[model samples]
Target: MQRRNFLRAAAIGAGVTAFGNTLTRTAMAAPAQNGPGPYGPLQPANANGIQLPAGFTSRVVARSGQQVAGYTWHNAPDGGAVFADGGGWIYVSNSEINPGGGVSALRFDADATITGAYRILANTRLNCAGGAMPWNKWLSCEEIDLGFVYETDPWGAAAVQRPAMGRFKHEAAAADPVRRAIYLTEDVPDGCLYRFLPTTWGDLSSGTLQVIRAGTATSGSFTWGTVPDPDGSPTATRNQVSGAKRFNGGEGLHYANDTAWFTTKGDNRVWQLNLAASTYELAYDDSLVSPGTAPLTGVDNVTGSSSGDLYVAEDGGNMEICVITPNDIVAPFLRVTGQSGSEITGPAFTPAGNRLYFSSQRGTSGSSSGGITYEVTGPFRS
Candidate 1:
């Protein structure tokens, strides 16, 4: 079945409740393993100075500041997710600039090289990060104070800004095929996590926007809280004040196994929201926080692998790709060094999971010395 039709069906089934339901039973079943090279981990190199594991290799897929079909020059590209069309085509999201910039629709060949690039949305601001819809469309979100969610077609033609999802500082988004709802993150102080119930699941034209309350879904109030001490230490109760949840910049959201995984850049932590129970919990503790110990590296953008592994794009300190396995082992899967002030973003795996694509942005020195999309070909052992 087509992804869009599937999502619409799931959304109708999910609306049985107002808050939204977890993915259906069949959708939650274990993912199937198909077509690949080997089961071992390997890394390689590319034109860009990115270093990967033993068997993996890297290449420059696309670069920023380059002139595409509609724009004069490409600005900062952020939060990319992969959409594998049935015809061996890949559509990537280039979160466009703020103050009126649109998302970039990039088409890639089977080898993962850029075939075409064009603008989808225009005259927007802070097009931070977004996820791929099951129907093969891209949902680009604005991260500004009065941001709105925009839906773009795979060819960069059809574009619509959805206001029902709430007008706030938006961040990353993830679509749950089972529930037919899209999970959203707000990149603001005291921002709340939200889920939008589309009046018609696959059709994002209209929906009901609701925030995730801590205690239960029955409560209509949108409450907030900080990451308390896991060991039960005496800490002050932080209220859900306007912009009180400092640094909880809700970024990098993805859904897998009936749960939602997201990153908190401000507090330097990753969390998992169990939709089944309407509860939130930490997926990776402070120990594995970005810029933390070995394995699990720090990151600014993150996505899920085909095998259920979590790939984090390290945006701070060390420029590397970190992978979180189902067993919770955090480790550096790839590293990008030698480039002046270069940081990695948008770590997404192809549908086959054989190739991993990512982008590097201008380093802290304000130089575009190393802005490129890298392809890591290897057996990503989950």
Candidate 2:
């Protein structure tokens, strides 16, 4: 098995979602990243205007409207994930530009050098956060009213739309291989958490979408109810299900080790859903930070390393990617100093876990046209 998959498979989730526990939160992040991080303190801003730890270096990989090698990079780059290729790997990113949003991919050599760049999906609208399937396809979602999810080929094949996943304001998708279900998040105040169970393991052509039976449930464990209409007709899919638990502005999601971790940008919180138990809790809550200092806010776009460290990027706060250890300590791993106006997005580590890639959706100009993608390399823990 690949080292990355092996690490995740070997992880033991801290599941507090026992069979008889009420819907409650477990304080995982204390003081909101005020503790000493494994990476130590970030050094002063370097030439790239980034504050990374000692021994770590940053370099610009691509910029909006600028040609990366040959292909022009897209604007408003958002959620991203990495896929393993023959000798190297590929990094796929979503473009959050309206009217002409889409997805793009960058090819890397085994040495982590960019070999090529190209578009994967196009002619879409407001393409936002997405999930990488075990089957190696990218589920690019749209963050608009009645949006859709497009499953695009990471290797430049034609994209296919999968409306069976629902047509609400989709933000992000997380596939749970253990349950053979795809968990989805809506980008609304009262949005619902959904799961699409395909007829088969790898085929997403058709499926039964269900909503979490929460909100009003006063039971030890929660369950899911069928979404009368996955098409989301007159009655929106979210509204169709009564008492479906609402996630405030859900932005990013990632599933591993039988636990699914997601973020709510509106509340500046990271949630933990124990798929094995069907119960969820707060992994990191800014409001619960001790001494009232929340180092990690604007919680968005979550990913984990093979070492079991959870990295949550900020959408607005300090433009930092805070690491939340399995032990629950949260601290800044890196920071973009001069791009305070731009939000961080698409944080993903390479398959070997040596290089980390992400983008500043608006860069220094703080406009959609000024997106800047970056790569950081060093002695990473995993």
Find the candidate with the highest TM-score and give its number. Answer: 2
Give the per-residue lDDT digits (tens) of candidate 2, residues 283-309: 677887765487899988988776667
Q: Estimate each model's TM-score.
A: 0.76, 0.91
Worst 10-residue lDDT window for candidate 2 reads: 12-21
Q: lDDT by residue for model 1 over 1-382, one digit each (tens)?
A: 1001000011112111101123222222111111122233424544456666666666665666655444333456676766654434554645445465566656666665566777777788868788777676777888776677888776666788777666677788888766778888888655667777789978887666655555322122234333232111242112222333233678888775466777877665676655555545566654533343444445468776544456677766567667655444566677776654666776766655577777776633445433565567776653
Q: What ranges in model 1 sit over 4 Å off? A: 1-47, 67-73, 111-113, 215-247, 288-298, 339-342, 363-370
lDDT of each: 0.59, 0.80
What's the CA error at residue 270 for candidate 1, in Å? Answer: 1.1
Which residue pairs collide, candidate 2?
33-330
Which is the leading candidate under lDDT?
2
